[model samples]
Target: MKYKPHEQGFSILEMLVAMSITIGLTGTLFYFFKQSQDSFVVESARTEMNQNFRAALDLMARDIQAAGAGIPMFLGPIASKDGGGTNSNPSLNPPDAILLLYGNSSFSPVTVKAQSSYPAPTSTSSTIYTDIPTTAFAPGNYILYTPAQSLMQASNLTDYAEFSLFNLPSTSAIGTVSSGGTVIGNQLTPSTFSINPSDDNTYWNHTMSFPSSTSLRVVPLDEVIEYAIDTTSSELRRNRNKAGWVTVARNIFNMQVRYQIETYDDSTATYTASWIDQVNQAATNNRALIRSVEVTLFGRTQMSGSGDRQGQRAIAQTLEVAPRNLNLPGFAPNR
Candidate 1:
């Protein structure tokens, strides 16, 4: 078969042009794929950050709701004492420390059996023997509420006395009652109510005292929860019952809290609300007036991947919670 030069399959120039077009299309596809992958990584990181923040907020909210659940009636529930320096990071900014005290929500209530002791330590006039053995009581802080007279038989509404238990000698000494006429004792010392009428007294007096056979309720000191931010580590941590702090969320940049104070106007028959920081509350000495809290949390994503995929992202979350235990009716202070 005789064929002319014009009838050849493909010239070098034409082949070169086709190859160049193919290479250009392949490069374009690779660029778009890389972009999609980078976008996916960033979006995934953002989602993870959001989820982590939400989980942390839920835990904090639950603890806040139960703050001061079984605290002694005379003691303030929320304490804004600044945990200025932590064991982990001392140079960190004085992040505000919040202490929530509640009773052993798990322990069952034990009853008082005898007024005086039975044998080993012998019964003292101030002893309150319980039906359970001394070993049954867990050695810790406790709240004791006793009524001078039963509700049905009480002529005065203020006949009940609430005592804060302190310096319990041991699990065996649970029956022993503090001195000073059943009033708030030394709190740090162990003693019985003084027989002298002139002694600084609380619930118990010469007339009104915890009577024998009276039903009493006792709850342990607290759960003692604290939330703090470690600026150095960029993390949010929680402290439980002075058991040390544990990290909750990583890459947390900040945690802020604001307290809400509520006041009731009798004449106007209305309630008023105000927001204040811990510093202002300290100046006013109205910590008891705090009714609710607003929390703002900030977090960020860790740098991940390489080159185009390597970058950090940030997120912020906020929430408001009311602690029913702290804002108990007829007990909380005015705003």
Candidate 2:
């Protein structure tokens, strides 16, 4: 069919304009789509990190609460001395004589103290029965004597006992000098003998004494529980005593631990929460005790490009754990 030259298909300029508009629209849509994808990736990564952090914290809290369970009492004995020492008595080479009592099912009101026979070792293999004054030894000194051995073992005695300063009571009873007895340079020694005159009469020559006792009573609580990150491989690993430290989440960047301690006032009947280290110091000085713990975790997205990614996502959380022995006198829970 005949057609005019003006009625031809699209001219070069028209085609160019059309292509330009199509490209512009496509570019705009592509930009928006890319942004949406990035946002989704970031959010997903953040969510995963949060879940991982929670799982880790929960695992830690559970284990910490279970610490010293079924374990020997002396294994978790409170520190009585500031220096290093084994938990065995010097004379008996046996385990320390600290007694542990769980006051409640929650294991929170626990008590640890030295047994009456703990500080002395008998000479004979048979059980020795002697009412030795608690004043014979220095207060807070780690005493490890066996009931089978006499407290006054001869100098010839070898392997007489094993003793560590850890987990001994902060205070001890000592013989008083007012009743013709003397405390010789913080050492309680018998100077004279006294008799009970009445049925209700007990020896009036004993006094409570306090000496340097530095020992750890509770195990320290871990903040992270478990967390790991590999920037080179873009992998994250975390575990909380589950199935042999299995990985719970990936692509983590960092993990941190913060602690909270509750300080109690006997006069006011009030409690205050403070940081872990601060509480630790106070507890060590017999000022306050640790009551709770908190944990925080941070993570990042996996790398998809060779160069560094300008965008990053963070996940954080906090957990609170109440420690055992919170209300006990002179006892501080470690977290």
Candidate 3:
């Protein structure tokens, strides 16, 4: 047969080379696209973890600052456990639990009513009545403040009466506010009421009265706030008083707290603060010595990534917060 240029076709070797070049270009493009997608996903996961860590820390900081608010110095303000407090046999990586005490100043104002036949505070009895339902008092220590009845005219020593709601006639739950605001049965105190007339310098006797009748302000000393991390669930939880635990943040891997103790150097005439773990300070009976707290929270991504790409990455945040009420004069002992 006679071969013509127009009828010519490529040999097998030439066709093979052309196919190889096309495959190489396609493979390179695919590789680049996959890498870009993976990077985007990893970045998104880290952003989510970082947001969760910040939220958890902000919630904790606000509550810590409220310690000892509206309550007398006699009551212990801050306490903490190195390991889990509620969990008896804690896990290998158990997070710390911190206890904070502050008055529920946010609660509705309740007034002492003479119409209910509420008697004046006496050395023998310290019972008082409020116009609101007994449920208004979250069964714990409370202060009866009669601002008009100060110990001295020009002094800051006002007549602040301290009493336990459990000591009242009928208080069922020790630290819960039930429906209808009424105290039903008498339950023993779970937390201590340390402010007594003999010991508490702020305690005094006064026959408080109002315009037409007599009234006194009922301020709660019962709010017990606690924060803990659930390692198993990777969540941060909080409980108020004797209430159930509420989740503050999810995908939280770890939580740690350190307390700051203020020490005054007599020779230097200066105050120096030291940060110590909860275990070391356990021997000291001074919760008031805790001037501030440092909190560290570690969070992890929920999603899992493939080989060489960790779907989960950890992010951490640290914050320091001072309890304003505790730093006030006469709040801390030996100050």
Clashing pairs in 3: 134-181, 135-181, 135-182, 305-311
TM-score per candidate: 0.60, 0.44, 0.61
- Highest TM-score against the true fold, candidate: 3
lDDT of 2: 0.34
Residue 253 of candidate 2: its Cα lDDT? 45
Candidate 1: how large is its RMSD? 11.5
**Candidate 3 residue-wise lDDT at 315:** 72
Error of 3 at 235 (Å): 0.6
Q: Over the stretch 1-335, how does candidate 3's per-residue lDDT look in tens digits?
A: 98665746898999999999999999989878877877778788888777777788888888887776755432235666665354432233467777666665565435654543444433223444445444455544554443233111111222122233222323553332223776432222333243221232222111111112244455566576778777789899887754677899899867777787654444566656677656222223234346678888878787767663655676778899987765433334221
Candidate number with greatest lDDT: 3
Q: Rate the local accuracy (lDDT) of all candidates.
A: 0.55, 0.34, 0.56
Q: Alpha-carbon error at 153 in model 2, in Å?
A: 39
- Candidate 1 residue runs with Cα over 4 Å from true position: 1-16, 72-75, 81-95, 105-138, 142-219, 263-272, 279-285, 304-311, 328-335
Q: What is candidate 2's CA lDDT for residue 276? A: 33
